[model samples]
Target: MAAAAHQADRPATGGQGCRAMTGGDRDGAPGDFRLTRRQLCALPGSAALLGLLGGCAFAARADAPPLPSDLFGGTTADPYLLALRAYIWGYPLVRAAQVRQNTTLPADPFRPRPPSAAGAAINRLGHAAELATPLMKQGVAPNNDTLYSLAWLDMREGPFVLEMPDFGDRYYTVQFGQADSSTEQALGQRTHGGQLPPVLIQGPDQQVALPAGMVGVRSRQRYMMIAERSLVRTPADLPAVHALQRAMRLRRWVDYAAGTDLPAPVSDQRPLLAPDTRCPAPLHFLEMLGNVLRDWRPDAGEARLISGLRPLGLAAGRGFRLEALSQAGRAAAARGLADAEAAVRAKTFTLGRNVNGWSVNYGGSVFGEDHLLRAAVAMDQIYVLPAEEALYPNARSDGGGQPLDGRNRYVLRFGAGDLPPVDAFWSITMYFARGLMVPNAAGIYSIGDRTGGLVRNADGGIDIMIQQEPPAAPRSVNWLPAPPEPFMVMMRLYRPRAPVRSGHWKPPAIQKIGGA
Candidate 1:
């Protein structure tokens, strides 16, 4: 019962048999589905919960679904429920690990990694020389407005020094995330303003002397993911952003203290996972979670929750073990994981308020104990900034509620003075399913207030054309080309205004045009 939220307006039955609004799958994983907070709360009882999970796993089988309760004590929950909760609790940590592993692994010749992948080994910084194109596949919901620089760090080694260049009023942020997928620190224009400072980053147990003019920041975990984003105003601005990215530096305490001439060699650590690998079996997935958890010590609250999972072959310090689980036990665990995967994908549609066919996703990386929401966010779009820093309002359908298809022409019209209100900037990016960029002959992936050659009406209203073929004449100047298939669009507002965040100011609905 602690897993579900109490909502006065939502039915207690969890909207069973309703036409669920679905979100995109993760990493193109087959048969993966997402869930939302409302849907999660709608789960009626244990029977209902078990039915949703076990139903997906055993739909085609004639035999009765596996009995998860058989594996546990009389008072404890069924293994299916325990494993489902565990999956929700550990999704972020495990997904983050997958991304970290893929980022650092050497790109195999046979496998074409996402063009935008960091591709840098551990402790090495990899900068994207240009903004993301259609071919980029590094992260979910990739934004074309900013170029990225990424790194994976083992903070147990020592304190690391991070330096930021003078970004004179440009919007930028360097997000440091812990292994458990919580935000450690985010430094940039919003928090630090124009005058940026050098930082000393270290783990909780790490302590080192900071040099003069350096600030110390400590993380709760030893494994860290450093993702830095710099705004790219236009195609020509790549060089300028690249320069700032190059100026940024991360070095071990020893290297910085000794004034080492050469950068420290990347640690000789090999990634245990391969790029674009199939999602592991449920047992294998839990084993991976166990291995990651062994390196991480949970806090008091986490320890309490994790303690309950011991009966399901999972403990905080000890990794997941298969030696004792019976064949039935394994099957139950597998069903539990499969159910969670489906629930996550099925519930992603309601992460935040939806107005005029657009979903304003909230929560970002600061999910405090709302594990289902966290897993849904991780599944749909990982590593989003907190709502205060940025708001991503996206849509996969038209105002009429039909799924957006490239076969039909559409227009996104902003009435005079109805542009998205934000302190920094805004952009509407075109994406295929799973947030991949839409490939087009025009090489256009996004358009916004900052987009050059944008033509507006005499009343100052802007009309953005969305279709497969280019529009004729002046309208073509505002065209955002889409693939000749189903697609989605996301509007990114950096430093969004209170009106947008509060849902008082809604984005204009996208209108389908008559016969193309």
Candidate 2:
């Protein structure tokens, strides 16, 4: 059958006999065999998809047993797939109207002219939209469905209506949660009970609304919006609910933008934008296409085809059977593992870019050493502030500069006048070149305001030791241990000012202090 034709119908369901084998009780006890209502609903779809895929393979090799229920063991792959399906269906619907609205520029007679600054803002929105599709497709599931719902509401109403509140000079981050008050309450507690009151203005009492100039306190750095109300409601009321939501969203965005000196917020006093309503139909068809692709055993050509269609398919709001998608993802991952193993066997592996200044020559595939390379490229990248720009953007190059050999013992000295400038705090964190948190002998991978018991020098200068051993006396307060092999560092400055952002201050190049 053609791919599209195969996916047009749902997978064939297995009978009770097949279920007794895979979904049966582990202990083989009589009472343990009962499947709960939720389990039954999930099982039919899950088993059918798996059985169909397994049957295809089995026909080719008669000796092959059916695919195992525990093919990926007790890992998170299953749950991740469920979340991915939800995200795929949820995000595009949520953001569809907003993306369309933003994409409709001023010169287009159909829509009002967005401000000149709208181009950059729309670009960022598009980037977010582009990222949402692929990121959702990756094995990692979203923490919640709020992002999806919010995008849907924006797409239905207009992007300009959803508002992010101004937090004044304070740094802030957006947190998403269910539309009910729970997520907002959690955010309030985290921000010391400083959040806007829940404004669920819907139904008969829903006010037509006006620009409610700066709705919340300027000092509040965090904002939360509960989109569940609109998501859970019937589709008929979605546009109205989205309209109210867009108003609030725009208000918040304006307040926040004004505080940050960003572009003036768009006014929403006019009538609601007419609904497009036609986009979802085509997208529904594309989702069916994705479902079929997930069932096929992927080769290189198939992988490329799926990857290319991923963004377009997701934008069109395709939903896949979670279990099927997971099985397909695992198959793809196995191929990647094979490729990596092949490279290692051929001894033709390229060291990651950051490995240039850091010598990684295999010592007969047993041990290797390079002191100077260890010190300079210890961390993949380092951030220095009161200099806002990242200090090390390019990977360390071997021929570019002499390595600062400090394998066993290293010292980083900051004079009294050289303290990092920040509105809130600063810290230097260490990570292995592989990007995992390093396991150091001293249990120290970072040092900053949060690191307890740091001692300062007599003249207010701080000298930190980056080495394997414990330092003597006051020197212990400044110790950040080194890994036996390669590593890297990152310095973070919270609430950084212009000087740091503009790179007015530069951190001194790391130097070798003593012999290894």
Instruction: Name the regions of candidate 1 deviating beyond 4 angstroms.
Output: 1-77, 106-115, 209-212, 261-280
**Backbone clash tally for model 2?**
33
Which 10-residue window in model 1 sums to the lowest lDDT? 1-10
Q: Model 1: per-residue lDDT, tens digit, 1-516?
A: 000000001001012231111223221112222233343334323242333333233222222223243322233546767777777778777766666666676443224334454446667677767667756533446677787777778776657887789999788977777776666467788888865688888887876766688777787875787788788887788788878987888888888878873554555433322243332344555766776777777888778777878777778667776654667777787677656655655556656666788876655567776777777676666667667777788887788877677778999999889999998899988876445577777888888878777788899999999988889987898999976656778888888889987788899999999543
Q: For each candidate, give its TM-score against the true structure.
A: 0.81, 0.34
**How does each model score on lDDT?**
0.66, 0.30
Q: Which candidate gets the maximum lDDT versus the true structure?
A: 1
**Per-prediction CA RMSD (Å):** 9.1, 20.9
